[model samples]
Target: MSIEIIGLDHIQICVPIGEESIARHFYLDLLQFTEIEKPENLKKNGGFWCKAGTISVHIGVEKIEKSKSKRHPAFIVSDIEATRRYFEENNVTIKEEIPIPGVSRFSCFDPFLNRIEFLEYI
Candidate 1:
């Protein structure tokens, strides 16, 4: 038998315990993702679910330790420049990425230091 991998169902990003509100502010307000109800059974676990287009983001709570890593979720945006400016206007920390031919991209850190990439094809 052969195994086939399917598409991504969701991406989970963790924030410190009791910091769901902060996560909500960033994902719901700043990023403008729509909130989705969690399963009744899963409500016991802190965090919330949200989606923008086909991307579903699950913000969960945990005790986090600072780390320097390049792991992030890259989101395809309609206007990269506008997205960059929006983050700047909101005081979000933006990271400049190496130039890629035919693509405009940059990264920014959320309130919890989770890096997110925004990109648009040129």
Candidate 2:
């Protein structure tokens, strides 16, 4: 028998405990993602949900520690240059990644230092 897999429903990234407001500013205000309602059962756990295009992002509350790694969630954008320009105008430090054939990509850290990547196919 073969195990069947499906598409991603959501992606959860962590923020420090009691810092949901900061996360809200980053994801909702800075990124312009639409806020979504979280179920009552999950509300007590803290954090909130938002939508970026068709992708749902769960900003979860947790104890965060500093780490130097390239771990991130990459979002495929339509215009990588415009996205990069927006990040620059917002004073977000951009980290260039190794070149991938036919792809233009870069990454930046959120308010809490979680790396998020943005890319476009050329």
Candidate 3:
């Protein structure tokens, strides 16, 4: 049988230990994503999950000191300019805009320094 790949089920973003609260503030308070309960089996391991539009976003705990900057998740938003302004007002570092033929977009680092991209279709 051929492989039939469907849509994304989830994306796991990693953060160092003891930074879950900081991550929550960025994801929940700033980004406005709703917090969701992690599975009981996984709760003991730390970190949590969040509902981002239709897909699940899992924030996993890592023991490392620094998070990678290049690898990231790009989210489709309604107004990228407004989103950029919000990030700026919140003091989050905004990276350069990535120009795609029919999209307006920019990238930023989360509280833990993990990269996140926001974009809107033209």
Instruction: State the TM-score for model 3.
Output: 0.91
| lDDT, candidate 3, 1-120, per-residue tens | 699888888889999888999999989888888999887999989998999779688999988767556878889998988988888898988888747799988898887778889889
Candidate 1 has which clashing residue pairs, if any? none
Using alpha carbons, what is the TM-score of model 1? Answer: 0.92
Task: Estimate, for each residue in 13-115, the C-alpha lDDT of model 2 and write its tens digit.
Answer: 9989999998999999989999999998999999999998889999999887857556668999999999999999999999999999999999999988889
lDDT of 1 by residue, 1-122 (tens): 99898877899998889988888999999999999999999999989999999999999888988664576789999999999999999998789999999999999888778889999999
Q: TM-score for each prediction? A: 0.92, 0.94, 0.91
Best candidate according to TM-score = 2
Clashing pairs in 3: none
Query: Can you list the residue pairs that collide in candidate 2?
Result: none
How much is the lDDT of residue 6 in candidate 1? 85
lDDT measured at residue 17 in model 3 versus the true structure, 0 to 100: 88
- The superposed Cα distance between candidate 1 and the true structure at residue 15, in angstroms, equals 0.4
